[model samples]
Target: MARVKKPKAMNAQEKLTFLLSLVPFLIERERVSVAEVAEHFGVDAEQIREAVRLIAVSGVPGETSTYQYEDLFDIAWDDFEDNDQIVLTNQVALDDSPRFSAREAAALIAGLQYLSALPENADRTAVASLMTKLSRGASAQPSQLAVEDTGSDATLALIRQSVTAGTQLEFDYLGARGTRERRRVDPLRVESMDADWYLRGWDHLREAVRTFRLDRISNPRVSEQPISHSAGDVVLPDTLFESSAEDLVVTVEVTNSAAALLADYIPDGAAREQLEGRVRTTVRVSHYHGLKRLMAGMSGVATVVEPAEARRVVAEWAAAGAARYDGDAS
Candidate 1:
C-alpha cells in the first residue's frame, strides 16, 4: 500500500471507527444524504464512502463470499460538488451504536468481562453465552441515551461508597410528589432501574424505604452512619415488571384535532380505542406526573375520562394555577 495522503485530520483507525459506527445508522435509514453524514460525523462525504467501501468488502471470503470476501455491500456514492448522495445496496440490520461511542465499546467489553468472570458453579452458562454475544455485537446499538452529567462527581462517589460500606447517608431529597424536604436516609443500595439510576435506600422522611432517583439528590454525602436494620424490610415491589397488571390506565376522550396529537403523546398500550371521530385512550403509568403533564399540555383538546382521583388532581392543579395568577377559572 502506498502512502496515501490522508484527509486533513483522522487516522485510518479513527476513520474506520467513524465509518463502522455510522454503517448501522445508514443501514437503518437504508439510504441517507452525504450531507447528513458529513454534518453528523464531522467528516467529508468522500471519507464516509471510503468507510462504506470498507464495509462493502468486509466479510468472510468465499465463492460468493467464503473467507475474506468483501463484495456484500453494493454501496454507490454519487459526487456532486454542490450536492452529494449515497445509496446502500444492502440493508443495515447490524448494531452501529458502538461505532458512535468509543467509551461504550470499552463499557460494553468491561460489562461482559465482569459477567463472564462469574464461576460455572453460578449456573449462568446461558447468561455467559449472551454476554459473549454482547461483546461481539449480537444486538444493534440504540440512539443516544440521554445523560445529564452533574458537575459533582462526589454524589456518584458517595452512592458507590455508601453501598460498599453498607453505611447510611444523609441528603435533602425532592420527592416525586413535587414536595421538597430534607431527610437522613439509610443507603440500602443503588440500582439502574428503568434507564434511570436510583438509590434503593430507606428514605427517613417518608418513614419508609423508597427509591430516590440519583439525579434528584443534592449534596449527597456518605456518613459513618451505623444501621443495624437489614434491607429485608425495604423490599421492591414484585409487580414492578408486570406491565399488563400495573399500567396507569388513563382514559381520554378527545375530538379530531386532539386525537391526532394523542397518538403522538400517549402510547397505544395506554390508549384503548379509535372510532369514527373520537378515541378513548388509556395509559398505565407508574406515576401521575407524566400523565398529568400530558393532560396539562393538551389543555382544551382532550378530557381525562377515568380515575376520579386523577380528575380531582388535575382540577386541583388547575385551580391552584388560577389562584396563582388570579387568572380566569371559568
Candidate 2:
C-alpha cells in the first residue's frame, strides 16, 4: 500500500488564511464531512477540526466590546461532535451579502461553455458540473445561453496534440504580407482574442517567438521532431501581439464608442488624442495587409488616418473588393 505524505504545518498567517477560506467552502456546501474537507484542503482531519473550533469562537465584537452569541460563528455542535460532519448554523455578515444575479450567472455559464468547447479542455465534466452549480446558486433562473463554435476544432485539436506530446507543428501559414509559406514551430500556447484563435510558438524559420492566427493556417501536421523550447524557456508577452521596433505605427480614427475595440492593437503608453468627436489612436502592425483586414471588419466605424501606405492599402483592398461586385451588378 502507498503511504500518504503528511501536509506541511502551516504558520500563523497560513492558518488564518486557511480558516478564512474554509468559511466560504463550508457556506457554499451548507454541510460536508470532516474527512472530505480535509482531503479537499490536503490536510489532516484533526487540523480541519482545530480550524473549525477556532472559527466558532471568532467574530466581530458588539457595541459592548464583547463577542455576543449571535455575533460569533456557530455550527451544528451535535452533527460535528457525533457524526464528524460540519454545518454552519449561523454565519455573521455573509448572509447579507448579495449573490450572483441571473444575468451574471448566464454570462459566466456561457464563458464556461466556450471553454468546454475548446480542444485544450479535454476533461469537461468539471465545467458541466460548475455550470449546473451556478444555475442552482444564482439569485434567479438564468436565461438559455449558447456560444457558437468557430469551426476550428480540427486545427485546434492538432495543435493541442503537438503541445501535449512536446512536438513541432508544420503548416502553410498565410502571412500578414499576403504570402503563403510553409513554416515549422514548436507549439507553446493557444489563446483567443475577440472571436479569432491565435497560436504563440517558437518559429523555426524566423528563429524567434511568433504568433499565428488559426484562420490563416492550412495543411497543419504534427512533425516527428521534438520541441526545442518550452513556455518556460522563453518570455511570452502578456498581450497577444507584441510590438517590436520593426512594427509599423499606423494611426487610425475611430468613434468614441468603437475605440475600445482597438485595445489589443494599441500598445501600452501609445498615443491617443480626441479630434473633433472621434478618437485618434496609433496601432502597431507587422504589415499593411493586416491593417487592411482590420479596417474591413470595422468598415464604416474606422478609417486609416496616416502613414500614407496604410491608407493606400485599405483603399486598394476596398477598391478591389468593390470591383469584384461591379461585373455581378450587370
Candidate 3:
C-alpha cells in the first residue's frame, strides 16, 4: 500500500485568509464537493471540511454582543455528512455587497463582443457564456450592445490560417508610400488597435519585419513554403512602426481631444507642447506620400506645423482632391 502525504499545516493568518475566500467560493457555486474545493485551493480535503465547520459558526455579533442563529452562516448538514458536499443555506451580510451597474456591464459586454470578433478568439462559446453571466448578474438590465464587423474577416481568417500552419503568405500590399508590390512574408503575429487589424511578419522582400494593415492587403494567398522565421527568431520593435534613420520627422498640431488618436505615430520621448486647447507634437513616417491621407483623416483637426515639404505635399494632395469636384453641381 502507498503512503498518503499530509498537506502542510497553515498558520493562523493563512487559515483566516482561506476561510474568508472559501465563503465567496461556496456562495457562488451554491454547492461544491469537499474534494473539488480542496483541489481549487490546493489544500487537503480535510482542511476544506474543517473550514466549513468554522464558517458555519462564524458571524457578526448583534447589538447585545450575542450571535443569533439567523445572523450566522449555515450549510446543508445532510449533504455535507453524506456526500461531502458544501452548500450554504444562510449567508451573512453578503447580499449588500456591491455589484456591477448596468452601465458598467454594458461596457464590459461591448469589449467582450470586440474580443469575440478576433480570429484568435475563435471559441465563441466562452465569450458568449461570460456575456450571459454579466447580463444576469448586473444590478440592472444592461443596454444592448454590438460590435460592427470591420469587413476584413476574410483577410484576417486567411492570415490566421497561415500563422497556424507555419506557412508563408503572399499578398499584393499597398505600401504607405502609395506604391503597390507583391510581398512574401512568414506570418508572425496578428494584432489590433482601435478598429484596425495589423499583421506583423518577416518580410522576405525587405529582409526585415514589417507590419501590414489588413484593409490594404489584397490578393492574399498562402504559400506552401514553410515559414523560415518565427516571432522569436526576430527582434520586433515595441511599436508597430519601426523607426529608421531615414524616417521623416514631421511636427503636427492637433486638437487636444484628438491627440490620443496619434499615439502610434508619436515616438518615445518625442517633443510635445500644449497651447490652450491644441497640442504640437512630433511624429515619424516613412515618407510624406502617406501624410496626405493622415491629414485628410483628421478632417481639419490636425495640421502639419513645420517641414515645408510635408505641408506642401498635403496641400497639393488636398488641392487635387478638391479639383475632382470642381464645377460639380451635386
Candidate 4:
C-alpha cells in the first residue's frame, strides 16, 4: 500500500529551507525514491522533483552566465522516470551544512520556540513544525531559545481566525502618536518581525495595505462581511511591506544583523550587494528628516552609503546634535 502525499503550499522561507535540506540529502543518499523523499520531507513527490530541477539551474550570479556544469545539481532523468528514483550525480557545496551567525540562529530559535510554547497559540502545530525544520543541522535546540510574546493570546487568535476565514476585521488601532482609530481591514496575514507580531492587511478606509501592530489593536472583531477588495489590487511596497511611497531614494549599508531591523523599509527593486560580510541596501523614501533621524539612531550599525546629498544631510544632523551636547556641557 502506497501512502499518498498531499500537495501543500509553502511560503518563501519554508520552500527555501526544504530546498536546502533536499540538496544535501540527495547528495548523501546518491539514489532515493521520489515518493520516499517526499514522504520524509512532508511534501508532494512532484515538488521534490521540481526543487531538483530548480537546483539544476541555480548558481552564483554574475554578469555573464558563469554557472559551470559541475557547480549545478545533476539528476538522472532515466532513473527518475522509470523507477521514480532521484539520482544526484552532483551537488556542489550543497552537501555541507549551512552555517548561520549567532544572531541569525538566535532569532529563528527564539521566534519559533516562543510561538510553540504559547498555550493559546492558534498555529501551535505549524510553529512546532517550523521549529523542528529550522533546527536541522543546527548546534542548538530551538526549544532552548525563547523570546517574549508580543501580543495577547486573544488578539493573535482573532487575527489568525480572520486571516484563515477571509473575513473583514474591525478593530481600533493605536497609531505611533497615540491616536486610536477604528479600522476596517481585509485580513491578509499575520507576520512576526523582530519578535513583534503585526497584522498585514488591506485597510478599506485608507484604500491601502497597512501593517498594524498586534499589541496596539483593541476590540478586535471578525466582521460578517467578506473582504471587499482583492489583495492583488492593493500593492504593498517591498521595503517596509506597507502601501506608501515617497520621492527620495536612499542607499545605506548595514551589518547583516542590522539588515533585519530595516527589512520593512527596503523596496523589492532595491539593489542589495553583499560586501565583506555587510549588506548595501538601497531604498526610496519621501521623508529626508525621518531618514536622517533613523540613520542617526542606528549609530554604528548603519551608515548612509550613497546619494551624497543624503550623506551631507546626515552629517549636518550629527554636527548639530554634537554642538547641542557641547553647549549643554558648557
Candidate 5:
C-alpha cells in the first residue's frame, strides 16, 4: 500500500477565504473577476469560485430587496451567442494600497530585501527601493536588486491601449520549444500574473482563445484582423499553459545515502522526512525531461520506485551517458 502524500500548496477553500478578505477593497474601487483575483493572488480556480460567491453576496445596500450587480461591482458573462463564461465590466483600478499590518509590513520589506539579491543591472531597482521609501519605519537599507527588461513586449501598457481602442494585432511568437511562429490574433484582453505579462486573444488558427507571453512576441501588427471582441470576456484557465495534463507524480525510495538530496529538482522539494535512515519521497512535476535531468544529477542518491515508465526513461538516459564515457580515458 502507498502512503498518501502531503500537498505542497494551499487548497481551494483556504485560498478562497484568504482571497475573499480582499474583496471589499476591489469592490469599493473597481470591478474584477474571481479568476483575475485568483491569478493575482497565486491561487487555484476553485479558490476563484469562492471569490465569486463573495462577489455575488457582496454589496452595499440595494434600493430594493434584490441588489443590482452593476451597483456593487462590474460582473457579467461573455459570448452568449458563442460560449458560457463570466466577466467583469469597466476598467478597474486600485483604489489605493491596503493598510498593511505590522506583520504584512515586515514581510513586504523582507520581500524587497530578497529581490535585492538579483543582478545589479535589474531595472526594478527603482521599484524595489520603494520598499524603503514606502516603509518609513525600516531601520536599514536592503541590498540592491535587479532584473532584465525582457524585450519590451509591451504588457500592461499595450493591454490598456488595445482594450481602450479595441485594436487587433499580428506578431511573431517564440514558443516553448524555441521555435519562432507567427500569429495574427484578435487582441481581446490583457492581464498580469505574478509580474509576468500575458495577452488574452482569439487565435484564428486554433479556432479558440489563447494567451501569449507578451515578452515572447515581437512586432505585433495591431487590429489588422476584423474580429469584434465582446464585452465581459475573461480568459479561461486551460489557455494559460497550453498543456492538458496533470503534474507527474512519482514515488521514489531513497534510503540511507541520499533521501535529503531529492529536493534539489522536485517541485517544492524542500520537504523532509526520516525513516530508519531511509526515506521515501514523492515528487510532483510537470516536465518529464526536467525529472530525467534531476534523476541523472542525483547519480546514485535516490532510486525511483514507482511509475515504471519514469524509471525506464531515467535508466535509458543514464545508459546513454555511460556509453558516452565507456572505455575511454585512464
Candidate 6:
C-alpha cells in the first residue's frame, strides 16, 4: 500500500489571513453550514471543523499562556455538531482592516516607487491602479511622501526585464577604483536599503554571488540565452558590509545616538556596555582609509577603544584636518 502524503504546513501569515477572513465570513453568514463553508474555502470539512474548534478554544493571550473565558471565542457547540452549522455566540471585532499610519504609508509609497523603476513592471495601468488603491486606502496623502530614485533608469529597467525572463545580463560596472569591467551575471533580485538600490546576483565571470550597486552599473544588455544558474544556490548577507580575514576589527566607545551609524558594521557578540555609560562596539573594516573617513564625519564624538594602529591612524587624520583648517583660516 502506498503511503499518503501529508499536507504542507501553513505558515504564520497564511494561518493569520485565514482566521481573519473566516471571522468576517462567519459574521456575515450568521449560520453557515460547515461543508458549504469548507467547499467555498477549498478546504476539507475536517479542516474547517478543526479550525472552528481551535477558534473556540482560543482567547486574547495574557501575560502568561492562559486566557480568561470572557476573552475566548464563543460558539454554539450543539448547533455545530448536530446540524453541521457554525453559529458564533460572540467574536472579537476584526472585520475592518487596520489603517496604515502616515509614516507606514509613506514607507510603502517609497518602496512602490523603487519597484516602479523596474522594466518588468511593464503594465503601467496595473502599476497606476496599485498606487491609487494604496494611496486611497491609506490615512495619508501620496503627494506628501517624496522618494527619489538615484540609480540609472535605463540600466535598472534592463536588469529587471532580464530577471523576469530568466535570462542572463551583461553590463559595464564601474568599480570603487573608477575602472569599468564587463560582467555577465545571472540576475536574481533587486533590493533597496537606505534608498540605495543593489542587484544581488550570480556573477558568472567571477563564479560567485555578488552584489552590484545599480548606480555603478551601465550599458546593461539582456541576453537571448537562458539563465544557467539556480537562484536558490545564491545567498546574500543580511548586511552588505564586506567581510574578510585581512579586515581590522576596531572597537569604539560610542553614545547611543552615535552608535546608530555603526549598526551595520558591528559584528555579532562584539557590542557591550561600558561603565562610562557608552556602548563598546567592534567594527570590521578593510583599512585605515575607511575608518579615517568615518571618524572625520563623526566630529570627534566617537573614541577608538582598541587596536593601536587604528588609534594612530585616527589621530593622524584628525591632525591633518586641523592643519588644513588652520591654513584656510590664515
Q: Best candidate per TM-score, number? A: 3
lDDT (Cα atoms) of all candidates against the true structure: 0.61, 0.88, 0.85, 0.73, 0.58, 0.77
Query: How many clashes does the backbone of model 5 have?
Result: 7
**Sort by lDDT, top down from the best:** 2, 3, 6, 4, 1, 5
Candidate 5 local lDDT, 1-330, one digit each (tens): 999654346578865667556655454434455556666766665655655555555555445756564345445545211232335442122222355555556667666654443322145667566775545433333334333444543444444455445665677888655778888666665555445667777777666777787878877655644455533454465334443246677877676676545543344543445667677767765556756756765666677777989989888888887887885642
Q: Please provide, for model 4 over 1-330, each residue's C-alpha lDDT reduced to its tens digit, 9 standing for 90 to 100.
A: 999756778999999988878877886677889889989997787888788778777755334657667666677878887888889776555433466655566688676665654323557778877665566535444345665544566777676677667678899988755679999998665666554667778888888777787888999998988887545556655543442553577889999888987766777677889988789988655567757757865899898977898998899989998999999999
Residue 256 CA displacement from its true place in model 1, Å = 19
What's model 3's lDDT at 86? 92
Each candidate's root-mean-square deviation in Å? Answer: 16.4, 8.0, 6.0, 15.3, 23.0, 11.6
Model 1 has how many clashing residue pairs? 23
- List ranges where model 2 is wrong by over 4 Å: 1-97, 116-129, 140-146, 243-284, 297-302, 306-309, 319-330
TM-score of each: 0.38, 0.59, 0.65, 0.42, 0.34, 0.53
Can you write out model 2's per-residue Cα lDDT over 1-330, one digit (the tens) per residue? 999877689999998889879999998899999999999998999999989998899877778988889888899999999999999998875744587999999999999987775545767899999999899778789999997656576788788788778899999999877889999999778898766899899999999999999999999999999999988798998888888898899999998888888888998898889888799989998888778878888978898989897888889889999999997997
lDDT of candidate 3 over 211-263, digit per residue (tens) = 89999999999899999998778877777777789888999999999998788
- lDDT for position 205 in model 5: 68
Which model scores highest in lDDT? 2
Q: In candidate 1, how many Å is residue 290 off?
A: 4.9
Look at candidate 2 and give me any clashing residue pairs. none
lDDT of 1 by residue, 142-165 (tens): 333323345333565676566557
User: Pairs clashing in candidate 5?
Assistant: 116-145, 122-146, 122-147, 168-222, 168-223, 169-223, 170-221
lDDT for each residue of candidate 6 in 1-330, tens digit (9 for 90 to 100): 999765566788987888878877886678899989988988667778988998898667545756767667889999998999999886643313487766676678777776677644557677667766677666566456655544576777787788778899999998655779999999876776654677877888889878788888888899988888746666667776666797789988877677887877787777577646567778887777768767766775688877998999899888988999999999
Which regions of candidate 4 fall more than 4 Å away from where they truly are? 1-148, 229-238, 242-293, 301-330
Candidate 6 colliding pairs: none
For candidate 3, the 10 contiguous residues with the lowest summed lDDT are 114-123
Candidate 3, which segments miss by more than 4 Å at Cα?
1-21, 33-53, 60-72, 76-85, 89-98, 109-113, 116-148, 176-179, 243-284, 287-289, 297-301, 305-330
- The regions of model 6 sitting more than 4 angstroms off are 1-111, 118-128, 138-149, 177-179, 257-263, 268-275, 287-301, 305-330
Model 4 collision count = 5
Candidate 5 segments exceeding 4 Å error: 1-149, 152-156, 188-196, 224-227, 242-330
